[model samples]
Target: MNARVEALIEQARGMTSEERVAALDALQELVAPPDQAWGEAWARESEERLDAYLRGDIEGEDFDVVMERMRQEFLVK
Candidate 1:
């Protein structure tokens, strides 16, 4: 790594957990900002799903039931 990044990492090591998280978030935004188009697409998708649910064209499962089923399918003993 470059000296500047190494120096930043060393500085980050001295921060509290929360401070480090905030710094990391700031750096991530600088590296790659949030995608507004993706957010708008998801918003539209969510509205469509809700409309379908209201129209009785789709059904929703209980959160706990879905979690239990997912655990059974994916978790290894």
Candidate 2:
């Protein structure tokens, strides 16, 4: 195994369960994509929604309401 990976495993082995969990969480967040994690998905969905509105595929929609719903649904609050 890689020396660094082995060292990391050894360190983790000494941590309490909670500390190990926190460490793994930090590592996952650190290894996430460079740009905002959901930025691309948000932008793509937004573009699709806008296009649908412009094309009259969606009617009488309250966009801000939907945005609020999305925020709540995504637990951004």
Candidate 3:
């Protein structure tokens, strides 16, 4: 392993069990792949958007209206 990783591992080894668990959790998040992190962020954003839509904080066409518009655009092409 790289020197930094080796050093980090040694530091983790010196921690207490509870600290190790927290450290492991933090490390896992730190090393998580970008796409996995992005997926989580996107999920959170989607939930927030849905909540806002439900609360009428966001205004937009409904799904059927969107679909109909898409169909008309496709037919024109």
Candidate 4:
């Protein structure tokens, strides 16, 4: 294992059980992707958008429309 990871393990070993749990919780929050609220909001939006698309409530552009739009927006030259 890497020295940094070994050092973190050694630090955790010295903590009490409660302290270890707190540390683990803090680590989990830090390691979690994009904070819970933002992720939930994004998921909700995606599900709504997908539902709309599936029901034909929302119209989607074709692949050629997408490619042209992307080229116009992103291509430098």
Give candidate 1 regions above 4 Å deviation: 1-31
Per-candidate count of clashing residue pairs (backbone under 3 Å): 0, 0, 0, 0
* Top model number, TM-score: 1
Per-model TM values vs. the true structure: 0.60, 0.42, 0.43, 0.49
Please report, in order, the local distance difference test score of every candidate based on alpha carbons: 0.97, 0.89, 0.89, 0.93
lDDT by residue (39-66, candidate 4, tens digit) is 8999999999999999999999899999
Write candidate 3's Cα lDDT for 1-77 as tens digits: 99998998999889999999988787777897358788999999999999999999998788999999889889766
lDDT, candidate 2, 1-77, per-residue tens: 99999999999999999999999888987898346657888999999999998999997658999988888899855
Which stretches in model 3 have alpha-carbon errors above 4 Å? 1-34, 74-76
Q: Alpha carbon lDDT of residue 72, candidate 1? A: 96
The residue pairs that clash in candidate 1, if any, are: none
Candidate 2 TM-score to native: 0.42
Q: Output the lDDT of residue 33, model 3.
A: 35
Error of 3 at 9 (Å): 47
Across 1-77, the per-residue lDDT of candidate 1 in tens digits comes to 99999999999999999999999999999999989999999999999999999999999999999999999999996
lDDT score, candidate 1: 0.97
lDDT, candidate 2, at 64? 100
True-vs-predicted CA distance for residue 23, candidate 1, Å: 7.8
